[model samples]
Target: MSQITISNAKKIYHDTPVIENLNVTIPDGTLFTLLGPSGCGKTTLLRMIAGFNSIEGGDFFFGENRINQMEPSKRNIGMVFQNYAIFPHLTVKENVAFGLKQRKLSKQELEERVDKYLKLMQIDQFRDRKPENLSGGQQQRVALARALAISPDVLLMDEPLSNLDAKLRIDMRQAIKEIQKEVGITTVYVTHDQEEAMAISDQIAVMYLGEIQQIGKPKELYHRPSNEFVATFIGRTNMIPAQLLHKDGQAYIRLSDGHMIAYPALNHLEDQDVRISVRPEEFVRSVDGPIQATIKDSTYLGLNTEYIVETGFAGRIQVTEESTLDEDFGPGDIIRLEINAQKMNVFSADGKVNLLEVI
Candidate 1:
C-alpha cells in the first residue's frame, strides 16, 4: 500500500476555479472519502489525483515520488467508475485479465491471477458470462475485481455504488470494505452520500465550493463538527440561534425561544452571537425538560420514529426515537422537549467552530 499526498493543489477550468489550495494526505491502506454535494469539486479532486486533470500549483505524490506530471497509466492507480465500464463483448475472465494481458504476462500467470481475483470477488461461477448476462451487482463486482486484479498501489472509486439498488448498495459497501481491508490498498473514494461515507470511510473530508470544510474520522466529525456547514451537511441537525449569556467564566447561550443552554467555557466568546447545533437523536420526550414543543408530525420508520416537533424557542426540531418500544406521539400533540447541551456543537455567527470561547 502507498500513501497519497496532495499539497496546496489548485484546479481551474475555463477561468473558473474548481478547487483552491486544497491539501489532503490520505494514509496508507485506509479508505479516505471525499464527500460533498453536486458541483462541489469532489469528483474534480479525485480526477486530479488520478491524473485525469491538471494541477496548476502544489504537489501530488504517491509515497515519495512526485506524480503531478505523471501519466495516468504510470500513476499505478486503479479506478472504478459509477458505470461498470466492462467490455460488453468480453467474458468476465477476460475483463479481469485485461490489465495483465496488456503487460504481456505469460498464459499460466494470467490464468492464476484471473482465477484468484474472480474467486476473491465471488464471481468465478459467472466467469464465462458476458456483461449483459450479469446482474447490476454482479457487474459491479466484476468491475472491482478487474481493478484489483492489476494489484494497483492506490484505488480510486468515483461513486461506484451509485447505480445499485438500495439493498445492493448496502451489501456492496460491506463487501468493498472487507475486500479493501484484505488487500490493504490505499483507496480514495468520492461520494455525496453521507451515510455511505460514514459507513465505510476510515476518514472523511467534507468539502464545499471547492474548499475542504472539515476532515476527520467519522465519529469526530459527526459528534463534534468543526463548523455549521459540517454539522448540517454530514447529518440532520437542528440549528438554533442563541445569544451568549455570561455566567461563571463559562459561556451560556439562551435560545431564541427563551431556553438557556450552557456550553463549555473553553471557547471564550463573550457576549457574542452564536448558534447551537443539536442532532435529532439528542432530544428526548420529557415533561420537565427545558424546551417545550408540539409534535407537528411524526413519521413511523421501521426502526425509528422521526418526530417533527414545533419548538417555541427554535421553530422546529427533529427528534428520533428508537422504534423498539411503543411511541407516545402523533401529529399535533403537545410535548415537552429535553436538550442535551453537553453533546451540542457551538458555532459562531459566521459559521466557523466556536472553539475559542466556552459556552
Candidate 2:
C-alpha cells in the first residue's frame, strides 16, 4: 500500500484548463473519493492519477517515488471501470487469472491466487460462469476479484457502481468497503452520488469547475460547510437572508418579520447582512419562535415527514420532522419554526465566508 500525493497538478485540453494547481494527499490504506457533478473534472483527475491522462505540470507520487513519467503498466495500479469490463468469453476464474498470467506465476500459484480472490469477493461459486451468464452484481464481483488478484498498491475505481440497480449499488458499496478494509489497499473512488461517497469514503474531495471546493470527512463537510456551495452541495439546506445585529455585547440576527434571534457575538459581522443555512432536520416545530410560516407542501417518507414551509421572512424553507409526532401538518396550515442558533451556520451575504468560524 502507498500514500498517493499530487502537487500543483495541472491538466489542459485544447487550450482550455481542466485541472489547475491541484494538490491533495491520500493516506495509505484509506478509501478516498472524488465527488462532484458530471463534467466537474472528477473523472479527469482520476485518470491523471492512474497515469492514463497526461499531467501537463505538477508532481505525482506513490509513497516516496515520483510517478509522473512512469508508464501506466509500471504504476502497479488496478482499475475498476464503470462498466465492469470483464471479458464475456472468459470464465470468472480465467478473468481473475488474467493479470497473473502477465506476471508468469507458476501454474499452482496462479490458481491459488485466483481462488483466494474469488473466495474473498464471494464469487467462488460462479467461478466457471462467463460474464454473459452472470448478473450485473456478479459481473462486478468478477471485475473486483480480477483487480485484487494482481495485488495492486493502489486501487482506482471510476463510478464502479453506476451500472448496478439501486439496491445492488448499496450492497456492492458495502462489500467494496469491507473488501478494501480487509485488503488494506489505498483506494481512490470517483462518483457523483453524494450519499454513495459519504457511505464509502474515509475522506471526500468535493470538486467543481476543475478545482477542489473542500476536502474533509463526510460529516464535517455535511455539518459545517466552509462556504455556500459546499453547504448546498453536500446536503439539503435552507439559505435565508438576515441582518446581523449587535445590541450591547450580544450579537443577534434580525429577520424580516421583526423577529430577532440571538447568536454568538462576532466582531467581524457586527451590523452586516448575512445568509443563514439551516438543515431541514434542524428546524424544530414550535408554537412560538422567531420564525413563522405556512405549510406549502408535506411529504410523508416513513421515517420522517418533510415540510416545505413558506415564511414571510425566509421565503421557503424545508423542515423534516419525525413521523412519530402526534400532530400532523398539512398544506396551508399555519406553523411556527424555531432554529437553534448553535446549529445554524451563518455565511456572508455573498456566500463566500462562513461567519460561524468568527463566532
| Candidate lDDT (C-alpha), each | 0.88, 0.91
Q: Mind giving the per-residue lDDT tens digits that candidate 1 earns over 111-199?
A: 99999999989999999999999999999999999999988999999999999999999999999999999999999999999999999
TM-score of 2: 0.97
| RMSD for each of the candidates | 1.6, 1.4
- How many clashes in candidate 2? 0
Least well predicted 10-residue stretch by lDDT in candidate 2: 261-270
What is candidate 2's lDDT per residue for 130-205, written digit by digit as tens?
A: 8899999999999999999999999999999999999999999999999999999999999999999999999999
